[model samples]
Target: MLQSIQIMALPLQDLKARIDQELDENPALEVLEDRETISLDSMPEKNSEVESYFENSSDPGFSSSYDQAAADSKQSFMENALSKPESLREHLIWQLRLQPIPEEFFQIGELLIRNLDENGFHLEDPELLVSQDQHPAMKEMISIIQRFDPPGCCSADYIESLKIQASLVVDVPEAIYPLIEKHLQALDRGKYRDIARAEKIPEEEVLHCLEILKSLTPFPGREYSSAEPTYVIPDVAVTRENGEFRIMVNEEEIPVLGLNSFFDQVFQESGNNDQPGHAEAKSFVTSKIRDARWFINSIQQRHDTLKKVALAIVEYQRDFFIHGPKSIVPLTLKNVAEDIGVHEATVSRLTRGKYMQTDFGIFELKYFFTNAVTGTRKGGGSYGKEAVKAIMKEILEAEADRHLSDQKISDLLEKRGIKIARRTVAKYRKELDISSSYNR
Candidate 1:
């Protein structure tokens, strides 16, 4: 290949910096400051008439004083809420100290507990814990630890947990114990009649025993652990205005950047050749102005891209915005990219960690895309999986009188021209945390 001198396009990083500099010098572009929380319900009746929703109030006294108080309280609350909880190992050791056991046995239990998962299940077998000296009695010591509260805490498997629970039963129902020991799958599938016939007991008795089984805690360690709830901060806020959906970006959640005109004027006036330190003044002004401008443009670009992407999402998932999540149809990255005239990667980046607000609730920008269930009459009609789930939820909610089976749901979808298999309906239903017909 012949070597040749060639000029290629500027790197995105360099372009970004250049854009930032231009934005700094330009007065039209402004970076908004971090805004205070605004109550959507309390917004003025005519939002369009308001020049800028982002403009700050001129009430300086109330602004500074109230802001200080709010900041302090928020900091205190965050500190209190964010403290780390004790780990699973520490919890196990605490519990162990309260129990009476031989020193060597306690040591074994400690080792076993250390290897346990957060669910308190023994991940390794007790046989592996036995050293040459402890080999003989190690099995018995392991058995004793297995008998802890949350019956299955130290068990190797869920079957062992159920077995431990069964062992604790005072009056063993004739075949209930054995049936539980062997046919857990059959019970799970709601084959109570088969189990009852095999065990020679009434189906009601089998169900009652199953009820007892259901009461047992499969994971006892949950009480000792803390689970953090995710808080979704909406990027766009949708409101009902004149019986129509009006969308607005939640400006209160993000900071705004704007130029300080006083500083800019000072720099400009000081940078004249006649000034004592004109060069230094020019350099400093040039640098600061460049930085300020870049910051402002980056913020604006972020807002513009976010708004465009969100608006496109709104247009695509209009049914969902009007109705709810269930109305959300299966959509794809390509669709949005094509509609917005951007690359799939651009769409991905825009949607990353971004959320939207709608009449139904706040959701991530990516949540709108779902795979369609092909061959379903309605399913083929541009409906996404989210829409399918929405329809399923609607049907279930309306049918308060009785539970709708997966097959029944499939048939209903078929009637609506949505072709879906029974299993697919079951899978989506389960994903939604809606249990089977019997359980429901």
Candidate 2:
């Protein structure tokens, strides 16, 4: 048998946004005045006070003055950082206009600016520009922009950026200039002996060229913007005080909500009204009250769900909470969902945009769930990949000589309990920004 079953659920915050979108398209929806707007400067100073309320399309005869009243007192923090600065080419073109280059070279400089990369490299081929323009003026402009400040600001790449920097020193040896212009790769590779041999110069001379090279900023444009530090507001704060951990929802920042009491009285009294305008006013208040109550309830539900999920995480990763990162146990979303008797997706949704503050650090709820090392008895570890990464970090930290190759670290981990291969170890090491043994 086929049948249709209708189900009803209150809207979450995002669903409320969708409802608003729908209302924009729907003709029947209309905004009603809230209770507070009715009372103003001309009041008799009686005991009557204005109340807040909210409404949706479905309801027609309930008034809520409490829910909206609670939300009127809270504040939100959502400031964003300033955007990154402009590219190096934009900076150079401004500088180029001041120089009295020939008319032909000035156009070429403009062409060169168009081709410069974010790192201030001249990416466009001069030969291509010269052939297409067939004008000495265009070629001349390109060259002028190429010679703008930061030297290699318009060069095709870092090599040019460096060469331009080297050219600024009038007394720089001719041989040293060529070494930087051509053998910059060898210089970066610390192939001092090879560069010196090729240049027929002493290693000491190569060092001097490198000293000059080191003075230039490869990405000079980055210096334009001041680093704007962003502040993170934790959804939940868990701190240890007096030998016990305390869990608190940071409700101070979230909007509080309650129903309007005066509106509720109006709804109760209006159902008995036979008067013409009285019924409509009652219906309006009723709808607003329902919406206000639903919004308040949804907010409460969001908090409740977050609390359950976070508490479960704390309990499962007890060692991590007690100690720190290193003690983090293997855990997964399924582990948490099953423990909470909710679907994994439900657990995921509850945690999606939430953060927890602890003595260890503020972290995303999902950050605690990671793939395990050795499989658990039921097939998965109760710990997170972060825990495994922490284990690898610990092994490398205590390693002899303060450094260990990925292979050696893998071997040491296998001796303990982690069963990862050398390649996996290398992968994790790379993720941790641990350089190769030689580099370290």
Candidate 3:
């Protein structure tokens, strides 16, 4: 049980790493590479005389049970290996290689690529690349690099980036270039009426232009960011079939283990001999086999417990899976523990760093558990904090005409049956990294 608890606390990747380390340290433990079949029937039974020696000693329950199933061959080793992310510098260099630029300009392009920040904006002045005599050549090279795959990559600021991207579109309205160049602050503040009046265009046209602007990527270089991407392997998968939600444990990544047949044979053959040191050698082998068997069983037990806890979470948050995150109800570790017949600590340990892949998206197991926020009406059910946050985000997104203050947001939520205070709304807004009404 202690071993089960320890294994349960480890995430799937960490558990795989632990098993790899154990395989390196323990000679008795070996991976069964062939997946065609696994049968322990060929394993010899313990000799009657050897059984008498272990009968007197306390049994650690390792010899009682063994895994005989084969691992699923669908998950290959190469699939789990990490793939490095391409950086912005590499992407620009690749694009430069494809062009028919002269050899001398290639050095200038490489220098420009190296000076770009993570946002794809140049860090230094382009004029600094060469003397005044070669200023025209430097400007020409900069123009070429800016027109690479990610349209706005080599610009100095967001305004320049948007202008560069605007130039690439075939039928962009004549007013868009001026709107982005002159009235960026007004546009950010959602002052569409001001822009319409300034450009002498209709309000509807301003809205249409804004929609076109929205389609442009603000940070093009982020697509090929240099930072390493985190890879998550789901521990459980929830799928909807025939209007029913089904939960399945993801055991493909985990390897199926069995006792080494070679070690078993050696122990069996040596048990019958009466050499001076045969008994000590046999005892040592028995201890190693017992340890390996216990490790294998503990892994199986962890798998079973993880599945049970995951199923309980699915049952409790059924509405969330069917609808969406906004439909998530108030839940806690205690709720899942009670449903699955385990202690709260055990449930918590099993869920740590565990992720579940559903039709909606991949979410950590803890995302389903949320604190309850009381409802405004007396008989109404409490709301999950996550649900309240989702509603808040929607409200903010739709408030393009006028930003709603915290007090206004609280009153709106109260009308919807949520009993959140103004201060609480402000706190949640801050956590969402949303600015106040004035800033918006």
Clashing pairs in 3: none
Q: 1-440 in candidate 3: lDDT tens per residue?
A: 67777888999899888888878877788887633345689778768676666665587543423343322232343444445566889989999888787887887788888889988998898778667886776778789988897889988988888888888888888888888889878877889999999899998888777878888887888888768669999999999999887888887777777778877887779856998988888888888788789889889888888889878888888888888887888999998899888899998888889999998899999988999998878798898998899888888888856779999999889998997889999999998899989777
**Candidate 2: misplaced stretches above 4 Å?**
1-118, 121-151, 155-163, 166-216, 225-227, 260-266, 274-284, 375-383, 395-403
lDDT of candidates 1 onward, in order: 0.70, 0.66, 0.84
For candidate 3, report its TM-score: 0.59
Q: Write the per-residue lDDT of candidate 1 for residues 23-98, one digit (tens) a residue.
A: 5565534544435546689876755434343245564443333567779999998887678676666766777777
What is the lDDT for 160 in model 2? 60
* Residue 439, model 2: Cα distance from true site in angstroms: 3.6
| Predicted structure with the largest TM-score when compared to the true one | 1
The root-mean-square deviation over C-alpha atoms between each candidate and the true structure, in angstroms, is 11.0, 12.9, 14.4
Pitting candidate 1 against candidate 3, the one with the higher lDDT is 3
